[model samples]
Every structure is written in structure tokens, then in C-alpha cells.
Target: MSLITCSKGHQNPEGSRFCTLCGEPLPEHNAFAGGINTGLVEGTRLRDRYMIKYQLGQGGFGRTYLAEDTGRFNELIVLKELMPTGQGTYALQKAEELFQREAAILHKLRHPQIPKFWELFRDRKGLFLVQDYIEGKTYQDLLNNRLDNGQSFSEVEIIELLQQLLPVLSYLHKQGVIHRDISPDNVIRKEQDGLPILIDFGGVKQTAIDVATQLAAEKYGGSGTRLGKSGYAPDEQLRLGSVAPHSDLYALGVTAIVLMTGKPPQELFDAHTMSWVWNRQLNLSSDFNKILQRMLAQRPSERFQSAEEILQQLPAVSTVPETRVQPHLTQRQITSSNNNFIPPSPAPINTSGQGHLLDNSVEVPDEIVGWNWGAFLLPGFWCLTNRVWIGLLSWLDLSVVTLGIPTITISILLGLKGNEWAWKSRKWKSVKAFKRHQRFWAIAAFILWALFLIIIIGVILFAIAIAGFGM
Candidate 1:
């Protein structure tokens, strides 16, 4: 068989059953008629180093093969075979060049949560990417297993998973790398040495490249829209082409929904109504539900600003120990790290119903909700003292000063209170309780503001009535 090359540079047997380089089976060839004709033989040596062992798995982009590393004294390894394609061979070559560029970025990341790449090799056949072989069950596999059992994980369990996964994202974001494709299929959880290790770093994106430039080109080609699983992708990543750290968080949120519900995200979504079904079906904890909603927000801006932001914002698992929690989770830590732009700390966890462990007495007041007598008093004194110096109030000035001044005062007071209680105080026994306290004050402030608006409207209506009656 003369080494007949396809347009993609894949060599095959003279009358082969498939494009041996890629497992593109020869047209009309039976699936069982295979006997490693042209590809690397089971015992064959590559570059007089790594030895091919057996085939593992094959996909559109590449094929994974189990092999032996001779340089490492025949250490077991996995080879990812990158195939050549015809439709965009020139484009694919360019893509591979781009892929290698990104691969260099990933090679520098050293985290136990990330998969390790061994080496990249090329020969007369094609390009091959060799990485460490991690044996474990993928999140997808876990979902399938639970589905088979007609059961799903509890909300607490799902949040615990998120706690572990979010940290991996935080580390990546800190390094300026984004895992654009964060579907369950891509996240593998292996129990190695009694610890769960995250595997697969194939879809990482670097901050160096112009995301818009590449994104615009691949919007219709599954490079953007189809990069994730259908239901689990964020609305922005799926529809608006916004890819950021939040995009990963959105996928994780979707995965959490699936994990808790034991169904794929599409099943939980009502296309006609354009709403999720989990809320209707499950009686979920308000705290966990809120976190999920934030993660799945349709707008990127409305979502967490960064992976660290998401980590900081995620309410700690009610049942998990604080030490297992990430440091970025408390609002104070996030604000402190941000220099002067500090957000108030989260409220204490309410251990009511399932929150029995939470203690409200020790919880911090929401800095945004607590009373700031100083702000109100100072502003009132300034206005009263200066009234004689200023002229009579115009209609516009009255409206502005009447409504705007109070609104501004309330906002400042709440901000100050939130800052004091949530961030500054470590008096609370549990950070979870502090988180709950913050939520309570936030809701209370909102209700109070709404009532103030109602009262103002009532007074305006009364004034109009008096004027009309007099006239």
C-alpha cells in the first residue's frame, strides 16, 4: 500500500477499511472487519520512544489511545490523536496551530484539579497529544448511574460538589484561563488515593486571544453555541455569545440542577413557558435556590463578576465544615481583596427547618441594612443649618431633595451597616449564619423601601385631591 494521503494528511492502507490515522472507517466497510491495518500497531514504537498499547476512545476532534512511555521506563500513558479534516484542512491546520498555542498556556498550570499533558508528537501519520491517563467516573457517569437507580442527590450534596468544583474554577480564573466548555461530560471525578481528582483540560481558553475575534468566526459552527451541552449552558453563552468566568459558573449551576433533579437540564426546562421546572417540582432550600438562580442568570453582568466572585458569593454548604470552604466565599474577603470597594459580609445562616445549626444572635447585621444614625443625623443637620443660606425650594428642588436625599441616605446607611456586620465582625460562630443574616436584612431593607414609596405616592394623591376640591 503506497502511503496514499487524504487531504487532511492522514495515511491509510492501500485499500484500507478506514482512514487509519483517524478512525474514519472506509466507506461501506463493516465495523468488525478491523485488524489494525495502517495506524500504529499495538506494539509499535513512536519516535523510538512511546509504545502504542491499544485503542481507548475516538471522537470527532481526536482519538485517545492507551500507550506506554518508554522514556519514563514504559510508564502507562494516554495518547490523543488529532485527525486531519478535508472541509477545512487549511483551516484545521490553522486551528491546530491555534490549539497548540492554547496548549502552551495550559501546560504552565500546575493544579491537582487539572489534567496533566505528557507531550505532543507528530510523524508521517499525524499529530498526537499525549496526557496522563486518569481513571475515574465522570459527573456524567454519576448522573447516568443515579438515573438508572431512579434517584438523585440532595441539595446539600449538590452544593458540596459545587464547593469543590468552584475552587478549581477560581484557580483557573486567577491564572487567566477559562474552561469555556464546562459540561458534565468534560468534568471527570476520579477517586484516586481516596480523593476525588478533577480531570480533562481540553477546552481551556487563554485571556491572551481575542475571544470576540475567534467567537464571531465560530458562532454558527458549534465552536460557540455547541461548545456546551444544550440545557446546561448559560443563556448568554448559548444565545448571546458572552463567554467569561461566569459562563463556567452558569454551566456548573446547570449541572447542579441536573444533579439534584436526576434529569438533564432540557427536561427541567419548559420551552413554551421558558422557565425551569425544578422550583415547581422540588421544595428546595431558599439559600441554595438563590445561589443556583444567580449562577444561571441570563445576563453575564447580572451574574458573578468572576470565578472568585462566584466562590465568594456561594453560600457555604449548610452541612459542610468551614475549613473545607473556599476563602473567597465571604463578601468581606472579596471586598477586602478589592481594595476600597468592599461589599458587606454575608448574613449568618438561619438554621431553621434544616438550619438548626445556625445561631442568629451571633450573626452579623447586614452593613447595607443596619441603622447608620450618623449619616442621617449629619445630613439632616447640614440641611437644617444651611436652609437659611439657600433660597426657597423650587418644584424640582423639592422633588429632588425630598425623595433623592432620603433615598441616598438610606442607601449609604445600609451600605455602612452591611460593611460593619458581615465583613468586620468575626464574632459569629458560623459564617453560614452570617450569610443568612445578610439575606434577612437585604429583604427587610427592600420591603421598607417599597413601603416608603407607597407612602409618598399616597401623600401626593392626597395633595392633588385637596387642590382639586379647593379649586
Candidate 2:
């Protein structure tokens, strides 16, 4: 089961929905928000080069090993072994052909949602395909956990899931690459970003299966290793062994329904009737319902043609994360009662390295936000450096007429609102970089302020001495 860490460092299962020790309402667990489907090792070297750590799994193709690339400072990698035992002479030929064509293209595939394909090499033992190792639980794992607790994914979850995953398919299809296999097991909700990363591309699987199927037919006189999973894959791809862009769409639609109902494809699909019987099991919005239905349409031509079509039709901005309530009030909320005073930073949202941006919103990160000494000390000058141009309003002469009340008020306002405004106004390379820049200015401001105070005190002392001497 997947676990979530609470603020107090308590690890809680996702299903528990709260910190077992603290009883704090478990944070909204959206780890696999669009999870339709679906690592690490410190040890092991392969072919005297990659260090093998652990055996991930095994099947007709061969074994998968978690290995470390010593050359890359032991960066984690996944090694898929293709062992078509006793496939005779044609084994290497078939492997070479498939890997050269599919692996070549996949290696060139660069996308945030897909793992970086490393290399495909053969050895005395067998063939090995390498790729980056992603760390996380598959949607399937999460679904199983939920099922263990007598709950399935909700409608909202599926909707958000589609919002996240469809774009990945669209990119693949545009590149003329078909995932071939896209079950919950193939999609992983990355531990780092909480985004869905499509993994286990069908290319290697297909290559292994092709040779495996040949061996099966020649020896056992049988067929095996269908590229797409039963029920999850449409009839045509599984039966014909041919796939198109829509083939992936059909499989994805099946994966979605399975996630919602917490049931496998075998139970959800009616083979005898050649139709889906999942509607009675769960309630979904009509719009999303229609979208899934069209995606699952049995005929390739009948289904939505592309992932783009489905994405364009999915429920709108509902997938966008809801704005978090910061302790600070928005600009419009500022008031004269001092209740409008800017808030002190709230506890962090536990999003380190997540890089949540406030680009188009007022959301302030708890850690990198709060009173800005630089802005408060030198509002007019600091505004230019931080690119918060509007802050130059501190230069307004209204302070002169108000006996410095307005100037002091503006400075306080700058102190309170500076971080948020600067964050939104400028393009920062990173949160750390932004913090560093602000720290530098703050030190400068403090040094300048200290010098000014020292000078003022010295002048006052001299004036006092002069008055005493005159007396």
C-alpha cells in the first residue's frame, strides 16, 4: 500500500485518509489524480557495467532488474531482460529488427510524461533494454488499495485523471508512436511531481512477445503475448495484433472505467454481449460518461479519432488545482481595521521541489514568502530590482503632506506584500534562486539602514553638545 507522510513525520496509508497518530485530516490525497493505470535500487551491476540490484518481475520475455549505472554515479535504471529461451537462430534477428525500429524511435522520444530510454544491448545471457527508473505506485496499485478498503476511485478523480493523461497520449500519437499498452499498471503517478508518467512502452514488450510467440507456436504450437491487456485492450488490437492511434484510446477508456468501479476489465466488460456493463456499477457526469462511451466505441472508426478530441471534450478547468488559502489576504481584502494586515506565513504545503508557481494567481508559498526587509527599507529602489514596478508608488508625494504617515504605511505595506508581488511580477529561474536574490537585497538594505541610524544618532549627539557649549 502507498503511504503519505504527515506533518509530524507519521507515515499513513493513503486509504487511512488521516495521520494515524495526530488524527489530522489527511491532506487531500490526489497523488494519482489522473492515474488511469498504474522503483529503486542501490545495488547491482550488469554486463560488468550496470550493477543489478533487485529482480522486479519475470514473465515469458525474461526478467526485469533494477540496476545502477556506475558511469552516471549509480543513477537508477531499469533493465528488462528479453529471454526467448531456445528460439533457435531467428531469435537475435527478430530482437534486432524490433529493437532497431521501435527502440530507436522510443530512444529518441523526449517527453516529461515518458521515461528516458537509455540503450538496448545484447550479451551472452540474453538481450537487455534499459531505461530510467520512475519511483511511484501505479494507479492499479492505488486502485487495489482502495478496493481493499471497500472503496473505488470517485467520478471527480477519473475526470481529473483524464485531464492529466490524455495529453500524454496526444503527444505520442503526434509523434507517430502508439503506446500499444496503456493500462493502470503502465501509468505511474511519480512520487516527485504527482504527475502521471506513462511507462513500460509496448515496443520492448512487443519485441519479446513476438519471439516468445514464435517459440510457443513452434514448440507448443500455440500463440501468446498479446500487446494490449484483455478487456483493457479493444477486441481488434488484441485479436488482430495491429494498432492505431485510436487503439490506445480504446484501451485508455477501459482503464478509466476500471479505475472508477474498482473492478478489473474482465468483470466490467461483457464478452458475450460485446459491450460494456459498467454504467450500473457507478454514477458519472453525463458529459464525462459520454466521452468515455465514445472512447470505448468498439469500432476503431466509431471511437473518437484522437486523444486530442477527447481532451478538447473533457470537463474544463475543474482539473486545475483549487487555489490554496494563504494566511495573507488578497489586495482587495486589505482594510483599514488592521484586520487587513498581511498575514504571517502559514505552515508549508509540503511541496518542496514541486515548484508550484504563482504565475497567474495570488498563491504564496509558505516557506518562500512573508515580510520583505529590502522592500520595506527601500520601497522605491527595491521595487525596481524586484521588478514590482507598481511599488514605485512609494515615491508619491502624498507622504510629505501626511507627516510621513503615508510613507510609513507604504513601507509596511511593502514589507507585507513584497514577496508575493515580486514573485508574480518577475520570471525567476527557481525558488532557490529567487530566495537568494531577495536575501542579497535584504542584507544590503539592513546595512544601509544601520548606517543611516548611526549617522542620525551621531548628528543628534553633536547638536546636543553644541547647545550645551553655547549655554
- Which numbered prediction scores highest in TM-score against the true structure? 2
Best by lDDT: 2
On a 0 to 1 TM-score scale, where does candidate 2 land against the true structure?
A: 0.63
Residue 227 of candidate 2: its Cα lDDT? 65
Candidate 2 residue spans exceeding 4 A from truth: 1-44, 213-225, 317-471
| Candidate 1 global TM-score | 0.54
TM per candidate comes to 0.54, 0.63
**How many residue pairs of model 1 clash at the backbone?**
26
**What lDDT would each prediction earn against the true structure?**
0.55, 0.70
Tens digits of lDDT, candidate 1, 1-471: 465443234576677534454223232211112223234568867778878998765433444678899899788887765543222334345545766776787677787877787666665445667778777777777767654444455565565566567888888888887676566666777655222355544352221122323534565443422333457666665455456788878877777776666666777788897777666646666666677778777667777766666666666454333221111223443456455543333233332222221234333334334553332333233222222111112112336447666456444543454334333333333445545655554565466667998999999999999999999
Instruction: Give stretches of model 1 more than 4 Å off.
Output: 1-41, 87-92, 193-196, 202-226, 239-241, 318-471
